[model samples]
Structures are given as structure tokens and as C-alpha cells.
Target: MIKELLEAKETDSFDELCVRLGNFLGIGKAVPPKVLLRAIDDPPFADNLIVCRNTPGFLQSLFDDPKTAQYDGDAGKKKEDGKSNTELIAKAATAFLKWGKAGFSTVDEATLERRENACLACPNLSEPKNKLQKLVAVKLDKERVGRRTGDKTCKICGCNVARKIKLPGESCPDSHPAIEGMTRWNEPQRVAAAVAE
Candidate 1:
């Protein structure tokens, strides 16, 4: 489904496709599956919708060992470019989680420190207990946070889904630098995380 969406992105008529799908099925929601089904249930792309299954154990190691999950997809890129993937997630997480860490003046320093912390902590970054004290500590007036990450709502459960934040988008309170090679979870991860709740 995601791969198909990626293909749909390349089409000359994706705008029309999205519109047709939206019109036939629905528009935007918290997850993408519903919109996909809506596209399928209605006219146009429904019949042609393709589904691919995540191979069993394809990501088993990740689940078995989250330490590898946090591993940067592009370490060499970070070394050369001076940034790693998850820079945004780091920034947002830092912003969301900043408590008492210091030495963020340089990208190298922040990256090194955050990487070390994540490695040492090795906790699910999303867990409330693991969440930055700043985010939890701060008295936010807003109850449910409304974040903007491109994704769709689930059809099976009708729940909004989102992926984890990428580390590159993170910025140090002292120095806002790009984390290299990190990809912000487009939407699926966010949706997946939400569904876990």
C-alpha cells in the first residue's frame, strides 16, 4: 500500500487521483489505509489498488532489538555530511524531551551526546516514562497535541496513525543543526505508534 502510494506520487495525475480517491472514498484522515480503501471502494483506482505484506520477521530483529532500530540508516552520510538520520526526531524529541542535557552548541556535540544518550537509555523514545522530562514536565494547556505529519487514518480501526519523528528535524536549543540520513516517519509510523495506544 505504501509502495503503491509512493508510485501514485510519481503519476502525472496523482492530484486527480487523490481527488478521485477522495471523492469516491474520502479525503484526509489520521491514517492512509482508509483513504486508500475509499479510493478502492469508489471509482478509478480501487480495483487497481495493490497490497504488499510486510514479510514475517522482515523486521523481527528490530523488534527483538530496538538498539538496532535506533541505529542510523546512514552513518557514513553523517560522518561526511556531519549529520545522521533522526536529526529532526532528535530536535522534536529534544524539544519534547529536553530536561537537563547540556553541550548542544555544536552539531557534532549534540549528535554525539544524543546518540550516546539514546544508546545508553535504549528506551522506547515514545514511552511516557522515557519521554523528555521537558515535554512531560511542562504544563501544556493543550490536551491532545495536533502535529502535522503527512499520513492517513486507518480503515480497519478508523484510528489516526503516525510514525516516529525523524532525528534530522531536531534542533539543539543552542544549535539547530540537521541530523544526517535520518528520515522522519512520513505517517505510517506515527499511525502505528498511535494505534499502540
Candidate 2:
């Protein structure tokens, strides 16, 4: 059914296709899937939406993993990036000290999956964490359950792929240094616009 939705032609309305896809996925009516789909500017974004929707069953498998299910809270351990714990700690402390006026940033599921998929394909991304586990005050099962990662962190942004992508208006800053507003998720659209201009 999702595949059918993906196969929809340009003539097909994204809204109608999403309602059908959402129905098949059993996505609840609280937030219409069409609303989510509208955040997607293009088809690749739509493809990512289908791929990364975290169904309950999928989340269960992540929580079942021993390495991910429990929160070790070992922030000082040597990360795969080989930066010293002390150095990373200093960097974190500096950021914390400077942090101010943070606002909640939200994006529909489609945008996040699309950005994450881009990070997954980026060469600058070295070692990626298999999953994300964090402590939550509420202790709900779903909250405790870890979410799988497409990539752990971005070398360019010095932030985790999942976290960085979720920021309200962030773009990938790959090495080129002049990729202006180009993120891994929207490179094609950016290129098309550049060509047109």
C-alpha cells in the first residue's frame, strides 16, 4: 500500500496519497498524515517519510537490544571519533555555559527522516551510533525505548545526526564551504534552482 503511494504520479495529489498511505500504516488521526506530508518539499522527502516511520513493532526491537535498552550515562567514555574525553568534556561545558534562550524546534517526521538519510550517505560521517538512548523523567515504555540512528553525528556540525537534523531550520554544511542552503536532503532541489537561475 505504501509502495502504491510512492508510485503515485505527478498528477496525483500528495494529500490524497498520504491519507491512503497513512491509513495503511495505521497512523492515528490525532495528527493527519497529510499534514506531515505537506512539510515534504519533494518526492525523495516522501520516500524517506515511508522508510523511517517508527511503528510500535519497530521500536520494540530497538528496546529489546541490551546495549541500547539501558542508559549507561557514560558520557566520558572514549567515543568512536577518538577525541579525548577531557577535550570533549571541555567542549560540552563551553557550549553549556554559552547556551541561552533555546526555543523548541519541531519538524514533521518527513523532514527529519529525509535529513537523517542524507547524513547516512555523507562521507564526513565517520562512526555512527547504532541507537540513541536517553533517560526520561516520566519512565514510559516508549520514552525509555531507544530510537535507531541513520548516523550518530555529523563531523561538520559537531552534533548528532538525529539531533542536528531536528533543529527547526538547519542545513547540512558539507566541506565545500559554499553549498549555500544545501542540505543532503535537498541538494537536488537546490541544484535545480541553481540551474534555472
The clash count for each model shown is 36, 0
> After superposing candidate 2, which stretches have Cα over 4 Å from the reference?
1-102, 128-146, 175-181, 187-197
The alpha-carbon root-mean-square deviation between model 2 and the true structure, to one decimal in Å, is 18.5
Q: Model 1 over residues 34-127: C-alpha lDDT tens digits?
A: 3322322221112112110132232222122332223223432333245322442232222211211211112344443443333222222222
What is candidate 2's lDDT per residue for 1-197, written digit by digit as tens?
33433344444443444454454344532223222222122222222233334464543333343533222233213221455534433432322221111113356777766676666567776543334222111122322211234335556544455555665534566633345565566643235433222
RMSD after CA superposition, every candidate? 20.7, 18.5
TM-score of each: 0.17, 0.32
List per-prediction Cα lDDT, in the order shown: 0.25, 0.39
Worst ten-residue run, lDDT, model 2?
94-103
| TM-score, cand. 1 vs. native | 0.17
